[model samples]
Target: MSITAQLRDSVRLPGGDALVNGFAFESRGDGPRRALLESGHELEVHDLVEVFAGERAPTAVFPLPWPGWGRGVHSVSPDGSFAVFSGQRAVRAVSVGGETLWEYRHGCWGPEIGHAHTGDEQEVCRGLEHGSCRVSDDGRLVWAHVVVEPEDQDWQECWVVLDARDGRELARLPLDSAASGSHHLSHPDGIHMGLCIGMGQDGILLHWARWDGAKLTSWDLNETMDRILTDVHTGLPGFLTVEHYGADLRLHALDGAVLAEEAPEPADDEDPPCWDYGCGFVDADTVIASTVESDEDPDRARHWLLDARTLEIRGAVAYPTGPVDSCVRPLGDGTWLTYDDTSETLNRWIEAAS
Candidate 1:
């Protein structure tokens, strides 16, 4: 099956240095949509959200905390009222007016800070770096991986849930892994979340959790497979998409069961086609997957559409433009968004009318 996407609209990013990979979108009202953009280099970081509506200039611009280069964990609330920034030493909640609502400090990113350090705050750690955090779907809680120090023992790392409205610690769960850092994947249910941790060659760790009002429950699939989660299929309740070690795309249940799997069609004399870690469902029945730039030919990349239930290749997907990055984000509707780093523009793509 062949899939064609029409370019709905393109919004040029504010700063020429916008980090395409760091962009995130949160919808508000019916008029225009807002998205978070991170820019700047090294220690100088500027994070802001730009409202995109037709051809008019941005109606509003909201600033967020500057997340340093290495620690890039941050999220805007769905309602676009607040922003949360998670770094090596702290997680803070800031209001749209730039007020620091509250902050929670934790262990440092490493045993010692790198030369990139510029803040006056002093912190220390046991070499655990690359921490991450995400806001819950309801925008009421923040799930974060942080270091917890005990009075009689050395520091340890754990997952902590905080009240997003005031940054109050609500719950904590100790984690056992070799994860230097991790990323949080939010579920549409507002009660479940997934954490993916990369531990060098040891393999990846998958932590699935459910948060009730009273407690937090979780299960981890420890180094079972070298897979990176691409999309959580909320439509199917327990199903999600994963790129297995960059080799094949697999549909997996929340309990680590492989439901279905498939790889891209390989060319005659060329190398086997691999899927990029960035992929997701365009709807209940259609999945959008992309190819990574080949190491042998860095400029080569392509997109593939697949049957969500059968894992069959429906067809190759073509965009109006020449090439795009591997970061394909689903907008919950049938439409999706892709970023062009070269042009510093965010393009919305929707299936052409039948």
Candidate 2:
């Protein structure tokens, strides 16, 4: 499908070097809501009250002086009234109008480099070297993966499931023998899995495990790393990885049996890997995958379209404004609600007929 840029708006931020971290399209409000990371490592909330006429201004700029520096919000409540923020050594909630509702911090042996500020002092968790955290859908469970030193100062992977209401550890999962490092993906459907990817003994071994409400179902794929890389997609039944051998790359459906695979023209070069975080289900057979394109060496940048079920090449377009994070969602009148973070604008686009 050919996607053309329809509308674009550039808003002047208060501080220099302002990077947008999180954004939400408010349904009830007049315009969209955006959160930006300022130069001082602070977060600012800008409420675009009027969007139709192109006039935009922040309704309120909430300065979150957590601790080390401000990263941004990971999740926002459905109503847009509450948000969960993670930065440095602090993770807490803030009101929509700029008020610190609650915050949690830790004090451990470390420099005050990447710590979040609570109220007066900074805090860091014990052995949590450099990692991130995320809250569950209901905002009741908090999950974080950290790198810690155990017996010989080697980095071991560990997870902590905590009560969101009081910040108490409820469950812990440590994988010292199963896998080394950590990589995971989770959804609201109770699907949680972790992967350790690297050049291993069995020539790129892919170890994966799923949380099935009661027990964890684990599997392994001993193939060339490129094949696993090319077959990666989130829309399918399990952890899908594209395997690229010399002549072709087959999309492995991971836990699910192979649904479809692609082997494009040999001379055209491999069609690139699937990298979109969210996949828009176009139909039972097709999906709309977001891509970030570039002007110089467009193929090198992370951008392209693919068949949802088959992972085949379906034409690619490079936006004029270079590479940007974008999402395409079905909106009713044959148009999709699209947002571009690099341009700091939101607009609509229609998909071309197949």
Candidate 3:
């Protein structure tokens, strides 16, 4: 099968040497579509988050207080009023005017013995780098994974929910596995969130949680599949996309039941099996799976559209340009977005009508 995507829009970024290394798009409750752009060196450099809409200049810019790479996660609130930065030792909320609204600190992320200067903050870590965080749907709570050392126990981490208005801890749940770090996926329901913990060779762990205002409940799906979760389709509740040792893809329910699985179909005997970490639902019933170059095809990447309900390959998607990097992101509206690092531009793609 073959799919074709047209270029819906394209926007060139600001800043000469600045490239959009990471970004998050928040469509404010059907209002304007805003984006948070994180740009700088991959690690150890000045960084900034520029909030913009369409092709307009950034409406707001928040210069991060620290100068490290993915050592932490940062995001702009849905309404574009505030920004949150979760770092190795602190989680801080900053107002539009650059005032620190509130901050929550935790254990370090690297070795306890060494310290490095970040130009702004003293960088230190004991174990893994800090993970990611997401603002709740209503923008009233923040779900974050923070490093913690329990009494008489080895250093570890916990998933903590914070009162977004004041940065107060609302609830905390200890994670049992040895995680290099983790990332969070927020659900539309506001009360539900998914946490994916990467544990190096120990494998990946997926934790699904639901907060009922009074308490937090979670289920570890790793006890069942033990695969690295590549993406979560929040638009399709209970649906998750995961990769098995980079060899195959599986669609699973949040409750750990497998919905469907697929492996690459080699075109010939010498074609190496190819799969990518990038996969997500294009809509409730359609998923976009990307593939890297195989031994037989090194110059081109492939994008496969799958039947979300059955995980069957519906067709290969053709973009106006060619295959993007493996990090293609879904726009949740039957469209997807990709960044061209060389050109420093963002491209949006939509499936052409059948």
Overall lDDT per candidate, in order of appearance: 0.66, 0.42, 0.67
What is the alpha-carbon lDDT for the whole of candidate 3? Answer: 0.67
State the lDDT of candidate 2 residue by residue for 75-101, as single tens digits: 444344555565434556666666777
Clashes of 3: 5
Residue 132 lDDT, candidate 3, scale 0-100: 75
**Which residues of candidate 1, in runs, are more than 4 Å off?**
14-20, 23-34, 40-52, 55-70, 113-119, 122-128, 295-300, 320-327
TM-score between model 3 and native: 0.84
Sorting all predicted structures by TM-score, with the top scorer first, yields 3, 1, 2
Quote model 2's TM-score: 0.55
lDDT of 2 at 244: 23
* Clashing pairs for predicted structure model 3, backbone only: 109-125, 109-126, 110-125, 110-126, 111-125
Worst 10 residues of 2 by lDDT: 21-30
* Residue pairs with backbone overlap in model 1: none
In order of appearance, the predictions have TM-scores of 0.82, 0.55, 0.84
lDDT sort, best first:
3, 1, 2
On TM-score, the stronger of 1 and 3 is: 3
